[model samples]
Target: MAASVGRGAPAAGPEAGGALWAEVWALLPGTEEGLTLALSGEVDDCVRPLLRRARGLLYGAEGRPGEEAAAAALRRLGDVLRDYSWEKLNAGPWREISKAWRQVYTYGCLFGALAEVAAGRPLAPAVRLCDMGLLMGASVLDNVLARLVRVLQQHLPREQRRGAAGLAAESVRTEPRPAPAVRPEDALPRLRCPSLEHFRDNYLIPQKPVVLEGIMDHWPCMRKWSVDYFCQVAGCRTVPVELGTRYTDEEWSQKLMTVGDFISQYIVNENSMGYLAQHQLFDQIPELKEDISIPDYCCLGEGEEEHITINAWFGPEGTISPLHQDPQQNFLAQVFGRKYIRLYSPQDSENLYPHESQILHNTSQVDVEDPDLVKFPNFRKAAFQSCILMPGQVLFIPVKYWHYVRSLDVSFSVSFWWS
Candidate 1:
């Protein structure tokens, strides 16, 4: 949107200034009262000089500052502009205007303060002036953001709030049907395949989760990854903290002690969930070995793709795995420890209450062990599959099947998935 006000020109008259102020104020809602306050009596006098300076910067005619000085000024201006708004800084309708201001008027709000501070000039007014500038700038940006959101909403459909195209189409294509109840005894019978080709052709493509018993016996790390040996080899390179928090990324490289601390502190604790995307620990694992062939007992669907993710756990107490479904079939294998899992079928969508957006919400309404049905009325009717996974046991999770996992002991698991 173009500005209604003139650039770097003295207000033609109070009438002209009032017209411009009114035009700007009209962009925002619920601010008529504040606009009125701003226009009463001497308001133009207060806003004129700042507006002139801002206009000068906007036209690419202002003097430049050092890079560090410019960055500090921009950041300070951003903070000041965001503080007066109820929303996050630089979000919504006024984003473009706010961004433009940041670029052009990099040090407009702090030039005097910077000069005074550097020269030890002790200019008391400069401090107050800078603070006031920041507050007013925030107010201006807030109004702009509000307008931007309104404009966007006017042109877009509600479903476009967060792209629901793929998820919606998939849901429609698969008519809701009840899945067969999976029993604990049924878990052991399906642990192996006759050949890798057969497994890939049958199960992997279908996106089913399976548990395989004794597969770890083939892995070199099955014996070497034990907790005691890990503790001995890894000294005090990095200290461990509670789950759901971040730790030093350089710990393992800096000192071998960090690796043991990571396992003991993270793997053994129940109620721990480390966000895989945040720490980037998945990058540290070595690539799949060429000698290791895909197992037959495992299943894959035709023309499907696979994704592998590993999570390390070490707690005797189990972590809370919130109820969620994966897009692809999931195979969860316990490598060195044990965990208890509860599963729910996709047919239970109404009860699970999937998020409206394509991005899933990281929260669940029902608590697995002791659900408060009053809070989640549909939870009592939800169906589930349950099992305990030990080293070498793998569980096959069908596509869109909801499940919650809890570590029963210090354990490690790798999830292989395919679509």
Candidate 2:
């Protein structure tokens, strides 16, 4: 009966088991020091016995512990595992919990391997348990850890949680020992609503980037598209949010949330940068489409004018769009904020070091602001034009021209794309 009980208990459903595993896994450590710290009373006492047994099983102990004690400890752990929800497990500092869990799983694997050697058995089932634990630990880090951190930041008081800016500051790479030399260049020219013939002859024909003023002054969005206005109009509408300071990082990802929640969490409160980028939000909210006009510049392209694609770009200050080129001519209209934009002509594509992958072919691998010039030495030769685009202005970006944009302040911009 004791053996049967030890071998089996009412198993939690997959969803519940996964949540429990994530919670426990989050409590483990990833390094030797973290493992030692976690085992030194950071985790629940009930978990200590199982961890001990895991160690013994892995290290080839003479025998299992007394049946009653082992069974009782197992029962206790099982109860906690089955009863706790993600909410309960995630109530504390998730980074600490995740580190602890990784440590526990690492030690558990070591213990399992040693026990297999000591027992002189064909294979011990406990080793499989250790393997599962290791996988769970990895899953916690790879999948849900960032989301958990975000949630913790949102709920906890400022003093309790490390600010997201501190985390971002840590990632800023120091300049290379000897910075690569780069040539200086002139700013992109600004023109005030030049005649369509002048625009076609001087800019479009030459395939040069230029900032056009007085183009967006007539758009309703220039006056009416404040954060509060968006919340009132599209608060409940769900939208895909880019969750990172920039898309260049591997840690960047996307999530879906109501526009109102996005405004409150990221725009108003100034949490970590969240972007409504490259999304055809106007298609989903036609009422919003009525507020802006596609610039006549798009019609200058060879493609049918009626087939223009519009994408919304809305984010807080410090948001960055890493150097990238589009397949179509782009008219980026600044509706309510200022943006620092740099443009590199397509002729410099060889120096840009575009990513090899087809999916990211349009995106440059090197960060424009702080390029690793040693690794991408040719980038030093890439001359560029730049401008600070203000509200009620439009920047005409010829198709395939490399552009990197950074918002100087809370900004909303729209891009009209055409062949």
Candidate 2: stretches off by over 4 Å: 1-185
| lDDT, candidate 1, 298-367, per-residue tens | 3344432333433334333344456777675666766665666877767777886654555455335566
Question: RMSD to native for every prediction?
Answer: 19.7, 17.4
lDDT of 2 by residue, 1-419 (tens): 22211112211233212333233334334332333323322555665666544433222231435433333334344334323322233567655555555444444433332233222222223323333333333332232322232222233343222222322322323222222232345677889989899999999898888889998888888778876567545554456789899997888998866565676667765657889885457755556888999887666778786688888998887899999998888899998767888899899999999999987999999888889999999999998988877788899999899999988777889999888
* Full-model lDDT for every candidate: 0.42, 0.61
Candidate 2, overall lDDT?
0.61
Separate clash counts for every candidate: 40, 21
**Candidate 1 runs further than 4 Å off:** 1-189, 194-209, 232-257, 263-316, 355-359
In order of appearance, the predictions have TM-scores of 0.44, 0.56
lDDT, residue 372, candidate 1: 80
For model 1, the local distance difference test gives 0.42
